[model samples]
Target: MTGDPLAPRAAPLHALPPLPPECPLPMPVQALGRGRIANPPRPTTPPNMAWRRFGVIGGVVLLTLVATYQMWWLLRGDGIDVLEGLLLVLFVALFAWIVQAFVGAIAGFVLLLQRRPLRMGMHADGPLPALSTSTALLVPIYNEDPARLMAGVQAMHESLDATGQLARFDVFVLSDSRRPEIQAAEAEAFVALRGRLGANARVHYRLRQDNHERKAGNIADWVRRWGGAWPQFLILDADSVMSGETLVRLAAAMERHEDVALIQTLPVIVNGNTLFARMQQFAGRVYGPVIAYGVAWWHGAESNYWGHNAMVRTRAFAGCAGLPELRGVKPFAGTVLSHDFVEAALMRRGGWALHMIPGLGGSYEEGPPSLTDMLVRDRRWCQGNLQHGAVLPARGLHWVSRWHLMIGIGHYFTAPMWAMLMIVGVSIPLLHAGFSWGHFSLEGFTPTAWWREQDGDRFIAVFVATMFMLLSPKLMGWLATVSDPAMRRGCGGALRVFVGMLLETLLAALMAPVTMWVQSRGVAEVLAGKDSGWEAQRRDDGVLPLRELVRLYGGLTLAGVVAAVAAWMVSPALLAWMSPVVLGLLLSIPIVALGASPAAGRWLRTRGIFLTPEECAPPPVLVRATELRSPGTNGN
Candidate 1:
């Protein structure tokens, strides 16, 4: 009789047989020479690449200098208080962050304009190379809908079969679900899927009794039990979908590059039906490429892995990416929530090359359906990223790896920092009542005389510069889209794309205040030692109820009102300046509710507004994924 597949086995990782010679697996130190695998030689950055890096750095420096000069000039009054000084420092820090993104946007603009290939560490010069080794495709699922999960898996499996290279790959559904009902549903779905595909199908499913380290542990368990069976593995999230050709290419790339540990493809947002989701989908499809290419250009060998939709060398991952329980209690300690970045860092530390290929397509994932859902996800990410503060100073880590960690941390920290900056700015006028209003007049402004006032002219210049830096990236993304005829047509032509951009920008601005408050609260909660426990993502949660919306954003709206009133109490001019923030906050409930409406999204789709290339001409894999109905009632 056949034993239960879910039962744990005694198979140790070391007991697995060695890979064939053609696979070129990286051997452990004991198998090679001494108990130490020599560090692989690092690739030298090309002269042009070095210059690009320098150009980015130079641009940031120039912008930061201009901002700093303006800030200093603004605070040059005789009666400048401690609050004003603190505001200046915060402004500098915040402005520097803005400048960094602006510079990167410029780099992205240049790269897209050149239309050069973005394959950084790829070896093939002509046609795609043939894949020589086998790869295991892993989907580590939590308490997700069984039918939905199986549908995606089935679509991918069928796509791979269509490529005629299905023998080279095996698909595994590694479940970490704790609910009995969910587990039963998953088992039934798996059985039905396998039954339909026949016995020759390589699709397999396993449910772990003990979900030790969550997703990371789920993957690690596979590595210990079956990772040795394959030369490489592609990690995928529950919502992730990739085409057969893309999968074959990724496998071929890994097979050709022996030193490379990981290759991350750009996963475009797809299947978003809500207004918020559709906006995100459009922005991701349009602007994501430019930003991704810019980052890939700089992060050649030390690139990061984004957990899902990426392939990794099995041996490299097994040998180097075994995560240790960080020394702490909860949240900032214990199992790392954001394991992808740390895994990449560990792999790079072991001298394995990591790269992100932005030029490659066919990878797709879903976006959050609502603002509330997005914030929930962001809170967990905030904790995970902040936890990387401990890993940043680890011995033997490359500088680039540390930079990745810092960038992750900075992403969340910027929210709180901006909140603090706004708070300080509002209080400055109230604290120093002696400040003159004569120079702060909005009418008939004289630049030369206003500059002599030490605050008004400089503050206006700084505000304009800040806005420019903030919006320039979107403009670059727009330029990149319109410049390409195919892309332009795919996004509903120039006029529609332009209109869509304007709408997206307006919605983004409205949402910014709400997001800022949510994130700031998240940061505060983390600081207060609160842990963001793992929860299943609500992928198909359409529009939320009005009461729920009010509950989520009522406090934000109140805060905005209070802030606006406080600003008005300080000065009418300050109140006018703070109108955007105030309006966004006061209108938070309706904004969120309307944005979460699927009807609005459908209306936009009908009008061909915010149309993406993938939506216009759906890829076969995506079409299949959507067309295949869920096998069970669990889909809803």
Candidate 2:
């Protein structure tokens, strides 16, 4: 796990990085990733793996047959034709899934179709309204690789300086870290950066004497202290960075649009040294465009605020941004840890526009370098987002806006529901054998008349329902994003976008059930009062061990096994749809793990088939200079 000051402190982080004072200038760029391979003869999904996946389907089919026979026997014994009775359960589940898919997909499509907002910037013509106004850029940090953290922040500072916009912005380093040692390190680092930045960068540093709501409290304290004097502010995480130009543009946009309370940019992911990070970077680069673009279209004035990589009008945020503590304890109550969503809502409620500026560039963030790290992060986010769900119902917000708020909350909920689908899928056959039709049991009791009316025909309805339930959301996201050019950047082209999306979907499909299982377990543990313990994620820096991969993806593999076993016991056809999930889980670790070696990254890049985002192009100086050695790391 990455360093967590608040944890038991298994690894005590130094107040400063372990790097010796004279330790070389720039760290050598980490090992290059598997270069993306473009249209490299759509490779086969390995035949040996097929058998295991097929085994799941074969089980589902076998169960369906047994189920069919049992239904026939029961109905005949009851002296009734059983065809309709057998198909009813399958039909109902199918109908529910299809309806949900269609509605969900269409909503997503509409969201995607609204991607034209990016063009608004092109017409603004000339330099951004020259702003005399001053704003503060806030970078909140904990236990991160201070060197890398400094590098990222410095890069942004330099970019701003490079653009002659240095005078317009001042930067602050806010730390909530508890370990006295790391604090000592950060203080030293601040001194170094301050001297290096000089007057061009008015860098300031502060460690919270009291760490209350983690991040939000950190920001609130800043606001209470000096926000009253500033008109605008930019918030960033330890690993986040933005181009000076983008910062200036955002500041200008905020200045011009009096109604706009917040202007969030779609940040590209960078510093993906591990194979896992590489793949994530590639995926975000390729497929993320469409999603971001599509989302911007429908979002219009109602954009989501992804806490960091965004600029907020200071007066607006401070006045309207007070986050309410949730009503209970632990997970559900206390400070709204995930206060970004709520802040956006409150801004909108204040009649301020919270819009995403798709045209902006140079905004970037980093991903956890491994699956374990990713899940660790997700668990915390899940708790924060779930807490949002509790108050959304009666929050006096617009239905569209409220629904948007709920999506964050709903994300964790979906995992558990998905797990239930697996259990329910297993039971469908047993229900068929006894009841003829798939009907609800009333209070765990079926009326005698309902039982007697059973007649069985189970195959067709199950097939239709399965198809509808699975296909809806993808089709919607696809249709929504493909039409927008901004969104189109994520994919190679229109055709490429569709193909890539499907490929990604195929990958996600296989992974979904597995993730659901992992997430469900995480959610359950959390609900049962398990503390995730605020662990920081580890970065891969290009070399990853297979052992770590297996350990990380182990649960997913187990889920596949569990699914295969269930299908073999119940219904083979059921396994076919479930196959994607199984295959994904089984391959999860490897696909991510093995993909990051210098050898693989080189190979992928050779083919122009990659997973990194388009806008995340490595810095020009970094790209052009190889002798500089390393791209230093940050402490998060």
Q: Pick the lDDT winner.
A: 1
Scored by CA lDDT, what does every candidate get?
0.81, 0.60
Candidate achieving the largest TM-score: 1
| CA-RMSD of model 1 | 6.3
Query: How displaced is residue 438 in candidate 2, in Å?
Result: 22
Q: For candidate 1, lDDT tens digit of each residue in 1-636? A: 789999634333233233222323333311111123236665523347557767777788888888888777777766557877888888888888888888777777888889876464453233555677899999999999977888899889988888888989999899999987787778777776776677557887787889988998898888878877798999889999998888988898787677889999989999999999999999997888778877877777888889999999998898887787776656787888898998998888888888888778889999999888999999999999999987876777877788899999999988888888877765564334444444333332222233345566666787788999888888889999999998999999988888898999999999999999989999889988899998999997657777888888899889888977765655566667778889999999999998889999999999999999999999998988887753433322
C-alpha displacement of 370 in model 2, angstroms? Answer: 2.5
For model 1, name the residue pairs that clash. Answer: none
* Candidate 1 lDDT for residue 33: 14
